[model samples]
Target chain A: MSAYEKYLRNNRLPHILCSGCGHGIIMGAITRAIEKADLDQDRTVVVSGIGCSSRLPGYMDFDTLHTTHGRALGFATGVKFAKPELNVIVIMGDGDALAIGGNHFIHACRRNINITTIILNNNVYGMTSGQFSPMTPQGHFATTAPYGNVDRNFDICELSRAAGATYVARGSAYHAVMLTDLITKAIFNPGFSVVEAISQCPTYYGRKNKQGTAVDMLNAQKENCVTVAASAKITSDQMQGKIIIGELHKSEAPEYTAVYRNIVDSLQAKEMK
Target chain B: MSPTIKLLQGNEACVEGALAAGIQFYGGYPITPSTEIAELLAEKMPRVGSAFIQMEDEIAAMAAVIGASLTGAKSMTATSGPGFSLKQENLGYAIYTEIPCVIVNVMRGGPSTGLPTSPSQSDVMQARWGTHGDHPVIALCPSSVEETFWLTIRAFNLAEKYRTAVILLLDEVVGHMRERIEIPDHVDNVLTRKKPSVGREGYRPYQPDADLIPPMASFGEGYRYHVTGLTHDETGFPTNDTEKAGILIDRLHKKIDNNLDDIVEIETQMMEDAEIMVVAYGSTARSASRAVKDARALGIKAGLFRPITIWPFPANELKQYLPQLKQVIVAEMNLGQLILEVERNVAGKAPVHGVLRGDGELITPTQILARIKEVQ
Candidate 1:
């Protein structure tokens, strides 16, 4: 048996998801990361919000929390606090993370929670069938945006950096190798870390937004992407709205759990009499 | 002597109460009135290898508390007003999942961050129906700081004993008050959590053998079980079967409602021959208790009936108090929240008078006294 099978739920098979859907690919990447990290299968927790991406944990063999819309971060906060040593990972789509859960996402970054957030950014709401999202590109067409989206889109990588994510990166499902490496770095980071994977959504988002074939979308990502470090050194004219890929930000800060553990000493000293 | 008596604030007593309850984990963000609890627990919980983690927000704080409790630790979180508003969803999750945890709301002001450092009990209605579902909840309100510690311990005990979400309701006044409280040792406190009888082999996650309270098979203990907020089956899988759904709903209430006798908590002062009684809870009860004593001294028959268990609302016991009562004045910081329940219970036999203040400050004994005189 593959290392990934141990983390998969046995009862349910043949999930009701479309073919070539990137959720399965991302789940595969996550399980592989867990295997590579040698994380204890039991102690690892997977939490997700309401979306096609949210069902990933339910299909997993480990302890999972399938929570309300955009509330996965809140629930994961609980999981981490309950057992700081536990490896907690939150998996949700762009709509779930960058929109309804936008407040929590930014705050989680600021709090510097020791968890991994893998955002499957397809730029369109797949579960609810293509509603414009915070990450949806400008002029992107959706059911809700008939005349094309007029609102300026948010760059998730830039947002994560601004929100104080200790480790921030963007990888494309188009480049599976780079995506895996970025996800691994995020999982290994000690503080709030986010890896936004540009995933494919051929079923709804692709067919509607004119991204055409899944392969075409993959090529588009590859052509439009630039390394974060490369773009940082260059001016806006050289960038010209290119998707900055690779590790965007990486730094260290005192994590919440460690700082919290210090309170015991303070209280003990106070009561020494 | 037992202990030197002191006139402490209700909020201060709550801090002391949680100290006595043997709190090990406190994860809460600071909000009005309730901030004192996080303040006190942050100081006290760390003494005995315990911890107080100030989470990102109330949502994270409550989540952390719920998470900590699963590790077989006594955990709690404190909040009030808007912070309390943020905790409702997780509170419901705790209820449906039957996670043993304690939450304290030092209620002050408003439907929406109305008042912070002041007093309002509007959360009374929210505490019962705030979370968006039909599930049982065990809430306790303390009238004084003394009861604060006692009830705080009871909050943990009842949470463990019943395996349900327990609320410790304190007004700003009660939560911040400091009284000389004599807290008994660990051996003397009431603590509970059922151990698995099958020795982990025949352990079903939601299967309750006899008492309807299932043993907590903690995480990482080799006893794997799934827990969710959706309508789930005995095996903890999301299911839509009507019979299974019915059973799940029935057990949620049965765990607490059927055991209401054990869960029901109250404080009654001088009800023997009182013509007019005051019904209240939380810090307001302290004000009412004093009014009852003073009213009796002035030759007005007065008694105080306070509900310690606010959710399963002491329905039967409260119904008995309805008859032969000329008037029952329900004084609360919120604009007539708990009074609505009193009115429903008393039905019109004894005019249920409501004295309310929603501007985010507590109703004092003096204010309640004036209201009682006017009603008389």
Candidate 2:
């Protein structure tokens, strides 16, 4: 048996993801990361909002919460604040995190709470059959954007950094091993950490854009993505249209739950006096 | 030990009740008539070693409360009309997920932001149907500061006992009105959610006991389980089976409906030997109580039936009194809301008249008495 098998609910096999879907790769990476981090299974919780990616938690062997669309971060904040000892991780899709849940995403970052958020950016809403999302690139083809998307996409790593997340990183399904390493590092971060996992929705996103099968989409990621270290050495012209797939930001901040504990301690001490 | 007495606002009383009920987490936003609840809890929660968060929005606040509750904490959130509207989606999620938490809606007038500080019971219907889907609801209305204190605790107890979201529907008047209240030193019967007794291997998260409530396992208690808003089976995993969906919804309703005897509470005064009944609740009930006494003094056969548990409508209890009542007057601050329930329960056994004011004002005893005289 594989080391990650113990982390899965084997009874829930034959997941609902379509053939060539990259969400499976991301989910596998998360399980490996949790194992590598050596997090206590009983003390870990996986929360998700409504989406194809959000369904990942239901297959995992841990305390899992499948909440309303775009509200996973808010629920996760409550879980972490109420029980600071538990490790809380949130998974969301592009539309779940950026569109309907944008306000909560930014606020969760600004609070710098100790929780790991993984956003699976498949570019389009696969569950809703290729609806254009905030993370969809300009000129992308989606069911909602048959004439081609006119709205520009957001740089998720940059947005996370701007929103005050203490740790921000980006990885793709093509870089499975490195994605696991990044997720492990994010789990160790004491403040808010966001890892954007660029995933592929082959059934919807690939077909709509004629991006070929899942393998072709993954190969494209491998060809276009540049590591931050490598990008620094390349010319600006060479970096155009290239996705940076590495740790984009790291900083120290006072974690919210730890800061809140101080207030509670002092108040209890005063009452004792 | 003697209980402490103090002059407290209704919102402050709610805070006191929550503390007495051993509430460990509070998530809320700032909105008028209900803002005091958030303010006082913010100051008191940390002092008591509890967690309190002012979330980014009302929906987040409700989400936070449900999240906290899943970890076996007594969690609550407070909001007014607009915030309550924003919270409906998550509220529906809580209902479907069967997470135990308390939601305090201190209502003001509104189809949309009609009044912020004024008193209105306009949310009586919204509290039941605000969230989409056919679901059971437990809501309590408090008429005074003391009732607010006790009812807040009762709301938490019911939420935990039944494993459902309990709504404490307070109007702006009862939420903001100042009155003398005697707070008990300790709440004697604060209930917590039942925990699973079976081993982890055999435990099913959605398996109900004879009481129709499933024992809840805390997130870190080693009974690793799944919870979702989707239709789920006994194992707590989502299912697409039609029969399982029907059973899930049926159990959710039956858990509260089958146990209404313990969940419902009503106060009746001068009810015996009366031909006219006045049905009221919340701050409006205070006026109805006075009007009933005035009518009796005028030799009119009048009485009051105040439903403290507004949801589930106390229909069975109200129906029993219909035969004795020649006329029923449903007085409220709204144009009409709960009156519909009263009329339905009355079912033409007696004529039902509404004494309602939706103009950001309280329904006065004189107005209610005048209506009673006209009906007589």
Candidate 3:
């Protein structure tokens, strides 16, 4: 068994994710990241909104909150603010983060609160049995978009960076080791950090679009993905069909809870005087 | 000794009540009438060494309170009609997960933001059945500034005790109206949630006690349990088993229903030998009270039955007055919401009449008195 196995709730295993689903691999990456970050398991909380990816927290050993659809960031903000010492990690799917939760996602990034958010962007709502999502590729087939998706997709890392997240990165489940490293850095970041894990929903997204079997979906991720450094040297046309992975952006900003603590300290000091 | 008396609006009193109840966290957005609760708490919470946050929206506010509550803090949020509508989804989440928190909805006129500053008891039905699915709710409506303060505290107590979201239902009339109240320095009867009695290894987070309420353990306490909105067994993990789901839903309702004696609160004035009984709540209850007094002096036996706990509807208690009354008149600021409950409780035992006013105005004492006279 892997060292991160202890972090998982073994009894809750035989998880509901479909066979060969990337969500399980992403969950493994999260546990390894938490372990590598040296976070206090007792003081750590995993919060998630509704989705197949959101179910990741339910099988974790940490105190987990499987909240309403598309509101995990808002809940994480409260948990972090309530106990600033606790490690707050939020998990969501593309739809959970970008569709109904779009406003909260942007606001959470803007606040720069101390939280590590991992969005498993599979481009479809798998738990709803294959609805096209905000992150779904244009012209991709989904149950809801039988004639192919007409809506534009969100570039999650770019959105997070623009919304003021101190650290923003994108990685695919096909490269689990690299994704784990990004997640570890995000957990260590002092302000809001986001990791968009481009996962494959072979059961729903792959089947709907006739994107071949589970292995084919995995192979597609590998073939399309390009390292950030490799992407920089490529022309726009060369990078058109490529998925850029690895650290997209990082910056230094005062974390929200830390700033709030300063205000609290100053107010307390004034009261004493 | 006389209590220190100060004049305060109903909203201001809610702040004091929450503070006195040791509420350590408040997450709310600025919505009309209810905004004062957040504003006052913002200035006051930090002074008391508690935390107050202005969330992005009402949905976040409710979500935040639930999150804070799981960490063992007495958490609360305040919002109005449109905001309350936004909070329903999360409120249902809190219900299914059985996380204790308080939500204050200072209702304004609304189908959709019809009147922002005006008063309406239009949300009375929404408070009872706003969130989808079969779940229990405890909503307390205050008729005055003093009642607002005490009921706010009671709301928190009920939330903590039941491990469920409790709604402190207020209206613009009660929330903004200033009245003299003797602010008690301390309340001796304030209750906090009962913590876990067993150690981490021995604890089952959702397993209920004899009273159907589980002793809650805070997040950092080492009992790492999965809390979810999905139907789950005692283990707190999502279960697809129909048998386990049935038991979970049944227990959720039974917890509150079985404990209705401690939850439901109703006050009756001059109910004996009365031919006409006025059923009212919140701000409109004040009018009913005045009208009852005037009718008594005019030699008509009129009485008032005010339900402070509006969700359970006080149906059992309302039945007691069926024998002494020829008429049951429900006077509210909305177009006959609470009257439906009264009609159900009365069950054709008496002639049930509704005196409703939906013009974003209080149901006047004159209207109630006229109804009482006509019924008599």
Candidate 4:
């Protein structure tokens, strides 16, 4: 009944996301962002790898591809390179993007292809039932890490920026409107763009970490995150343990498809001459 | 137009054949014997306005080919032993999803990175059962540069026709060997994936026709359908229903099995009234071809049954010659791979022998001739 509802496959409704899961909220943000960006529903593709968050594309009303685990970027890169005219949006989970798929993730950023990648960082592998992931906070409890996780978590926004993403941003599921704006901007970018959407896994991640209910987790995001603009004014001591939310990086670069196209055009021009 | 004739390596001929077959996209990694496929496509794809991408790894390369194929592009990728092993993951995905793409595995000696520059047909078994699961496969083996050219085109055609991944298995000797080949002015009967005639409304992405092949709609075609690796239904959405999964898996096998007559191709040399038959494929077949002629010249009735389509196994065709065969010799670079398949099909009708070498050397015609003489 809502305007963005048209972007969903109503027939596939009653999504498999657990009660109070933040993936639904993030999914709404994605649909809203696609609508806001005015992407032709027919010309846009939603690709995902295997995971709980990766299942989101199956419910979208667009050309959707649910590929192998950790290979969404690889598949999306092919789609973008094959048909640069089509808008390619890739959805992935923290484990799907950073753990098994880490090589593809970095290479996709390095290629600077025109793809919008939204990584739903829920801190643990919810689909596989709370296994420790690369995004799991250090010393956190997971099913696999019974005593406590010793692995250091990646700063996703920093990693994306370092990997040559032309546009990098981070938003929480609590900030649904801000997440939509960030995703929309990522869609508009002419090169590779990454938006890390911190989502809550109430059933697995929250319960395993003793983080109370999903509502409590959302409230924690509200209290722990500082806007990049606001963080600039805050002292290092004041910003401790606070995640930064907002656009973290932006720059111009020659997109992979455009560079390839130039090579093709010049070769054809030589043939003409 | 006159056909251009030039000496070309088997890998180079594969590139020419792919271009002639209307390949619009290529995603590959650099690997021995197969690297030339990526190298030449890089130079030619730009000129032809098609897409060429060197992926980070073989897995990504295979994934990209499937993605590009979903856009209705005739896409392909090439790799060798280790790379082919890495590609198995995505190859299985493509098989389950029914994406039309060509995977060229120019095999080298390997259990694990054994020999990078050496020829080995060790991957023949891997080509059939590498990906895991009871899935259908269509694989072609070429014995020379000329056969490589035509088989590469045929691989793409079969991929499109069945809406499944086709493997072009070439060994290092055949892939690297150079020979003069005629470049035809035009390639006839290049098949593309069938597009749905029905409109976007009431469209089921996996609804098969009478031939059991579902017409594909490219990503941007407004059909807005879903594709997944999980066992899916006619609507293309993942289904957990046991019956639906059975139907899906069964149909995938039947589509290729029922069309085996149209798919399987076997080349026979002096098979008529021959009491001894040599079963070979890929570069090994070249040696077997020469050995058969040598046997005939020595007043012995020896023949060769070279399976061009190695995967659907060509059992029916091989069975036809079983009534007269006293013994069967399978010669290959591997110690023993396809020989198992030969024994299975021959089913004790004839004594089967293997002239196999795994030490990075081709099985010589003399070796095959000796085996034929001993069996005779």
| Poorly placed runs, candidate 3 (over 4 Å) | none
DockQ of all candidate complexes: 0.44, 0.89, 0.77, 0.91
Model 3 over residues A110-223: C-alpha lDDT tens digits?
A: 999999999999999999999999988899999999999999998999899999999999998899999999999999999999999988888999999898887899899999
The digit string of per-residue lDDT tens for model 2 on B233-340 reads 999999999999999899999988898899999999999887999999999999999999999999999999999999988999888887788999999988889999
Off by over 4 Å in 2: none
Instruction: DockQ for candidate 4, please give it.
Output: 0.91
Q: Worst lDDT window (10 residues) for model 3 chain A?
A: A257-266
Where does the lowest 10-residue lDDT sum fall in candidate 3 chain B? B43-52
After TM-score superposition, the amount by which residue A160's alpha carbon in candidate 3 deviates from its true location, in angstroms, is 0.2
**After aligning candidate 4 to the native by TM-score, how far in Å is the CA of B118 from where it should be?**
0.8
Question: Model 2 shows how many backbone clashes?
Answer: 0
Which 10 residues in a row give candidate 4 chain B its minimum summed lDDT?
B367-376
Query: Ignoring the other chain, what TM-score does chain B have in each prediction?
Result: 0.92, 0.99, 0.98, 0.99
Better of 1 and 2 by lDDT: 2
Q: TM-score of the candidate numbered 4?
A: 0.99
The order of the candidates by DockQ, greatest first, is: 4, 2, 3, 1
Model 1 over residues B312-368: C-alpha lDDT tens digits? 888787777656578889988766788888888888888888878877666788887
Clashing residue pairs in candidate 2 are none
Residues A1-273, candidate 1: write the lDDT tens digits.
Answer: 886788787786666667878777777778877777777877888888878888788778777777777878876776776578888889988989988888889988988979999998888888888788887778878889888888877888889889999999888877777777888889889999999988888887788777778778778888888876777798899788578788888999988777766766665777786
lDDT of 4 by residue, B111-131 (tens): 898999999999988999999
